[model samples]
Target chain A: MPEEVILQAQRELPDWDGQGFSLLETPFSGVKFKRLLGRTRDTLRELLKIPDHFHILFMHGGASAQFSLVPLNLLGDSKCAAYVDSGYWSRKAIHEAHRYCQVEHAAIAEDYIHTSTNTAYCHITSNETADGLQLSLALKASTPLIVDMTSDFLVRPIDFEPIGLIYAGAQKNIGPAGLTIVIVRDDLLGRAHALTPTVLNYTYQVEAGSLVNTPLTYSIYLANLVFQWIGHQGGITSMAKRSQTRSAMIYDVIDASEGFYRCDIPPDQRSRMNLCFKLPDEPLTQLFIDHAAWSGLVNLKGHVQKGGIRASLYNAMPDAGVVALADFMHRFRKQYADL
Target chain B: MPEEVILQAQRELPDWDGQGFSLLETPFSGVKFKRLLGRTRDTLRELLKIPDHFHILFMHGGASAQFSLVPLNLLGDSKCAAYVDSGYWSRKAIHEAHRYCQVEHAAIAEDYIHTSTNTAYCHITSNETADGLQLSLALKASTPLIVDMTSDFLVRPIDFEPIGLIYAGAQKNIGPAGLTIVIVRDDLLGRAHALTPTVLNYTYQVEAGSLVNTPLTYSIYLANLVFQWIGHQGGITSMAKRSQTRSAMIYDVIDASEGFYRCDIPPDQRSRMNLCFKLPDEPLTQLFIDHAAWSGLVNLKGHVQKGGIRASLYNAMPDAGVVALADFMHRFRKQYADL
Candidate 1:
């Protein structure tokens, strides 16, 4: 989503690697495609500091696919798993897991950690996009932790020691929507259920080096550019700092608005990726959205499930964009306070 | 894969619809993205002449994923489906279907039709890429026919009345690799197995209008462009004519080679999309491949399973490419015939 990535892709769209053909025209088996795949994996490993024991897979079907795949692949002989009830995404994972195994619902992260040790794995949605909440604590537990990092991946350094697997849909902060990135520990490779679809089988995919089927080659190519851009912009540490500053700029205005603007989420649990808040009334919320769009700030409407204002500051968002949003928020609060 | 599509996409990569953001950065819910999805579906429906009773679903994970999905969705209560074992792709579809239902393996197209009427459905791969064989017969059967038309999808007009469903991976004649196109009858919507992964559940996808989970927006966008290109090139009729002309140029050389070059597929069954052949020996085959690449006609190597020389002339292949390959083939045969 970076400008450099898009511009470079545009420049090379017609001829990739001087091959005299569009990259879309070539199959994944082409030498240049193979090299591009290797470079993408290498750059991702460097950016995430992925351990050698982990397999980084570029797959299709996004994070929703992984909700089913996690339980199907990791359940092993144990028919039970623990899933934290964080928000909408967590509920989806839990709902899908029920069709495969017995799912124990844990109200919080600590409850999942204290879940019966006999469970196969514990699951959490590290950042809930709809509810605008994020788990801020680092988890260490005997059971492998499987995190849906779809909304927060690549925004900060990760501690992968206790993670059995982490899957992120690339659309949020990585690259495109069709591609999903899965990093799984070596120990969790081959315990898929007998009926697991081959395209969703972790062992089958890893054995074929993630070429069991045709992958989203163009999406992966874009992701490779994104990984490089992140590296050039000082890696995950800088991403984390920018996210903090950007979210704080908007959150500071909401906090200073007293009762006019409200963010019900506890400050510690507020999502840095999606900051959801409510205006004084429905009319005011519509007015804010219309005025923001007039000022060239769009897509600020809240998710349908939660009807209020939601501001998402992903890695691609410029600091100036966030500053402009914050300034508009201050002006709107001042103008409407007495009305 | 058309030059026009690539060029147009490159032009819009940075500022899609003048939205000041890359298409890759927008979620499927964005107004522009929803419009793109609508336009893609409309273009596809128009290009394919899909019937009013059929639902066109854009999905992820390609036709390979649909192998399992077909059986899972259409088996109903019969739990038995007949699959024609045409070649590599057919065998794969059968193997995956075996996991979900009782698979009746038929050696050819007629065998599937003669299969018990009680069978749930019948499946076939209309074009086998590895064997360079195409099913040219028009099928009319009481049992619903499901075709894997991955390689020949957009090359010709399709008869959809007999088909319960037809799925194609977009890599070959359609657009890109990550997106799959599924056209299924209205009656085939809701029989998916209880355990079908939500992502692969056809009924769920249709209900959500293929927005069940962020459908591959960028690939679909590219496909829309490709559809427009096909329309501009005079629709499927012109594509079919071009394919015939292009393939005959190569096949004519092989037929005239006096055993110097051989294509074993019966002339009636030879694929217009992929023309597979061989030279007298392995060294000669390698020589042919090298010379073809040197002449700027690349990807002439056959699939590993069949191992000779395979020249795929999909919809995007210009007449010049096939002509160049044919001319090179003729010269190569003449130069090496006596050796």
Candidate 2:
């Protein structure tokens, strides 16, 4: 939520392109809106360095929908797909994929097992927001890899070659909720199961120019602006450096806290985007969350299922913001050590 | 597109409820976000007079998704469903439904016919934007009726009886693109085909609080604002009256043109939301479109298949806008008399 993007949306809300109508008022199929869509796609392709062989689709229903859609689209004649059960999101994706195909766990939680070579595709949550786990970029598989990059997309450089598809919900690093970005290799387009919902059919969406239905026009517009912001911030290279710097500050606090603060994720597997940790006890954890909130570091509470503390350091998070949180965590640990 | 609603969204964009984060930055499952969803549902329920027995779902993928979802959700063990071929949208619905079940044309375009009583349900487009056709509110059927009110929902009072489901894409009168509102009777739940996509499943959407995935948060917010705006504009009662007046002005002008313009839809079946008409020839039609654009009556060109002019007078359309279009049409016809 860059101030520039929000302000631009506000200014355009009254009349888009001086058309005496809101950008939301533009018809999804109209030339003006089509231009917006095309510009967004072009800009994103440039920023992400997406290969020409990839088809970028702007879809709805978030990554949760992609959890089901990926299997429906790629499982074609294969009855089994391999999935890495890295964390919360990966487990959810695995559960949904079971409806359409058999899901074999390639890697469960912290284990780094490989997928069976005969599987349709290997699925992985590149970064798990809730559990603070992430797959290394150098990780490879025998089967085509489908990555749920929801928490880490565009935050660093990506190698497109071992990947069949990469999908991310836009709420985190991309733009906003309600829009999902899917980058699928062109060869994977026509393999969807016949029963797949037309809206979720990648081929159908590509054919319809992502105007398969009325798209999230405003969300796409905001994403376009966010993409512009990323371009302004020196693209993924700068974002990666910033992300490492921010996450390290907080991880440094946890590592130095001895027994007072703990992060369960293996250091090598920890997510750069989300840092999850725990205090010595539940009450202390609650106190940490309240203190963080009072100090203007909100949404610091852990996801209810995995209670402790979790801080999301998304692309929009300023370096100073993380520095402040790291400082707060250090002060809290010292204050509570005597308790 | 209301200025007040847009401004409110802009103000709230930077920080919602003093949470020190953009509204878009709030977690989908967070308490604040859930409250926003609940308030929007309640406000919409109150405004639309939705009964307790009906489930109100704010979904994505727009009305086109519903074209497929209606059959996948309602057709059940019955392989046949009756659909009225009212106009462009109805035909599209029928075509999409064929992928899931056998479609019987209950009423072909230009005909009013009854569906077989044994069919799963009868479907109709309440208002056809391209052809300017609408089903009368008094129409009844032995089987339950599912209406695609994409172009006219909330523009007038609707009868609940005999209708099992009513769905509309929000871009017209409700809010913006990317969100679809589905009102389904409780009994229709749990009847979806086993192969139905989870995101489009009525039961799944309900169970997940319409959060089967990260919903179009901003779109829902805008829809909530539009709902408030509807209330401010004296509710649907006022809207219906305004719609009638605006449409009548345009229709009157067409009627008085005496061969200069023609509307093929039967007068009684003509849509109050979309008024489609043709001039004497293609050149005249093109001239009319060019002239309309010059007069600031944009998006007046009809659907390519229809090849004429279409003026959409949705609920948000001011009576003055329609009057101006009518005035422009009158003057255009006078200038082009020699042609």
DockQ of each: 0.81, 0.65
Tell me the fnat of candidate 2: 0.60
| Segments in model 1 whose C-alpha atoms lie over 4 Å from true places | A109-112, B109-112
For candidate 1 chain B, which ten residues in a row score worst on lDDT? B106-115
Q: Choose the strongest candidate by lDDT.
A: 1
**CA lDDT, every model vs. true structure:** 0.88, 0.85
What TM-score between 0 and 1 does chain B of candidate 2 receive?
0.94
What lDDT tens digits, residue by residue, belong to model 1 across residues A41-60?
Answer: 99999998999999999988
TM-score of structure candidate 1: 0.97
- lDDT tens digits by residue: candidate 1, B224-272: 8889899999998899888988988889998988988899999988999
In model 2, the clashing pairs are: none
Model 2 TM-score, all chains together: 0.97
RMSD of each: 1.6, 2.0
Q: Which candidate achieves the best DockQ against the true structure?
A: 1
Per-residue error for B186 in candidate 1, Å, reads 1.6
